[model samples]
Target: MLIDTHIHSDTRGLEDLELMAMCLDGVITLAHDPFEMKNVKVWEAHVEKLLNGEIERAKKVGLNLFVCVGMHPRAIPPEVDEALNKIRDYINHDKVVGIGEIGLEKATKEEREVFIKQLLLAEESKLPAVVHTPRRNKEEITKIILDEISTLNLKNSNIVIEHCNKETVKWALDAGFYAGLTVQPGKLTPLEAVEIIKENKDFANKILLNSDCSSNPSDVLAVPGTVLKMKIEGIGKEIIDKVSQKNALELFNLKV
Candidate 1:
């Protein structure tokens, strides 16, 4: 069974959900910036949709859905504290798995402040964190993320530095964190992802494959499609199973 460790189902269609259910055992939908959000109220409403509306929507297609709520770095408002308070109220929900899709966008001082606070929340709650690495200046931003993480007493195993490419993947793995390879447009393609796996010795244990499906250009079937690519490339089934399913299951503490 495959588990897509990251996706945003809020804007997906029924056809996509059905296709995913046919191929995947489950999915984790993370809270992200609603680009047009003007205030904390919008953030609150957006999260409510994830916690309530999206969960039921996934169930209709027989897809086991999980959630992670956080203020995306791009979406952090002037009143950051208010946004965080809202997250605190829902962080312990039965279906919530982590504090995620949270990290640097512009690497602003305010963004850093907000990012560090959420990291502490994840540490305090003993939950996994799914960190985002921006597409631009990825190396520099990822380094900053790692440095910030180092100051906290959080477990390495509980953090996933997501959207990692060849260079940043090594950084994440070297730092003892799960490295998420997102197979989405403008991210790593299936072949590139497989190439990274082939290059990194014993990397199956520290990798998580995801589509990061959302309103942006994405492939909802990316996790399964990548598995097919790996098979064609003669990657062993054992390793395929670990990256596509087992690693995510263990990291998220998913019972499915």
Candidate 2:
């Protein structure tokens, strides 16, 4: 009963692979970056394909699936209005559960503008967002997301800020936003995620567990790895269940 809160639903070559083999009961798929092509025309085409395509990849993997669609901060091209329109079009889809994988990155003016727009859309749609904090200068970026919520008076519980490490998690938890600890190479390890849970037991109510796997090579088994680590540390079964299953389901309003 594992739910990978952040993974790409469209696995490139793993079409025959099974989510059960990976020990996953479900997945929350964030949108692929549209501007990976780096041209407005190409980006627009990708958005159409992304929003309108059938979810064959998830069906092949045989997992309970949910989706989040928006412009990733790094991929927020010049045609952000067009991108937002696509997000708006799909936000109410039954399979779509959130409005993200968006937030600070490089922290440029363009990134900030797109991020705030997505946040507002999430607010208006009453959907939780899957926010991505930059790998570099993570704390500062996390603070920027928090500051935006304060400035706009957005609800904290409406977003789950991802990739939070020890130093940045407290800010998110203290502010009432969910803290998503991602397990991946060069990020939080299974041991590290458990340690953070141990360190902040009182502030861990909305803690989320995820693998952060995508088309790019990363540990797809990281979510299960964290559960194993938590067990090894004698963490309570209830705590593990909350982080890996219950919290994500509650945050995204998913059931599977």
Candidate 3:
């Protein structure tokens, strides 16, 4: 019942060793990046290869998947229009769930512009957006997102603030938006995450636990570890299930 909200499979139109390793390691619900490339054709080709790779990975390991095709904040403005058009079709793909991993990064002026622009694109496309909030100044980030939600009339139900920590989890939950916890080993830390989940009993419906498993191996398998911690903290299976499965389905609009 684990649905990973964020994952990147590097399909370089060739045999990807990292992807091979992920398939072997039992990763379900991978979210591939469609906006990772600078060239539109190259990005399209990469997405196609990722789709093929998902099919192969499914047959081999039963890996469920979700993918997004919008530029990350760091890699935008090269061919934004072309990239958006290319990804538009895939948004409705039978396996595709939403239009993200698409939001602001605390990188630079250029990155912020790209991120905000993509956020507008997500609004235009009427798809759920996955946002990467700054870890340190998260309250400010939350305020920015809330303002955007108001300005765009974007439903709180249509957004997920990813990699939220104890500092910012309450704000996201209070906003009636889905809050994603990125349970990395030492980054967000196991003890702090469990405490947050345990303490937020009232806002259970607004919470989702995700690995945010990236190219890094240590980041993978983080959801299971979080679940174990929740169990140890005397949290019920019902709450755990909500964090694990129900919230994801509600946020992604998934039938599963």
Index of the highest-lDDT prediction:
1
Give model 2 RMSD, 1 decimal: 2.2
Estimated TM-score for each candidate: 0.96, 0.91, 0.80
lDDT measured at residue 125 in model 3 versus the true structure, 0 to 100 = 71
Instruction: Return the top candidate by TM-score.
Output: 1
Candidates arranged by TM-score, highest first: 1, 2, 3
**Tens-digit lDDT track for model 3 on 141-215?**
666666656566553356778778776787777777778877775447776778888889878887877665555
- Predicted structure 2: lDDT: 0.78
Runs with alpha carbons beyond 4 Å of true place in candidate 2 = 15-22, 34-41, 44-54
lDDT of every model, 2 decimals: 0.90, 0.78, 0.65
lDDT string for model 1 (1-256, tens) is: 9999999999789789889999999899998986656888888888899999999988998989999999888877677888888788898799999998899987888888999999988887888999999999999999999998888766645899999999999999999999999999999999999999888749788899999998989999999999999999999988999999999888888978
Model 3 is weakest, by summed lDDT over 10 consecutive residues, at: 11-20
- Candidate 3 residues lying further than 4 Å off, grouped into runs, are 11-36, 107-117, 135-142
Error of 2 at 187 (Å): 0.6
Residue by residue across 1-256, what tens digits does model 2's lDDT show? 8888987645444542364335887787776573474665666565445444525555656656677888887776677787788778777677888987888887788888888888889888889988899889998878888888778887646689899999999898888888999888878888899999999877656898987776555677788888998999999988888888888777787867
Candidate 3: give the clashing pairs: 29-64
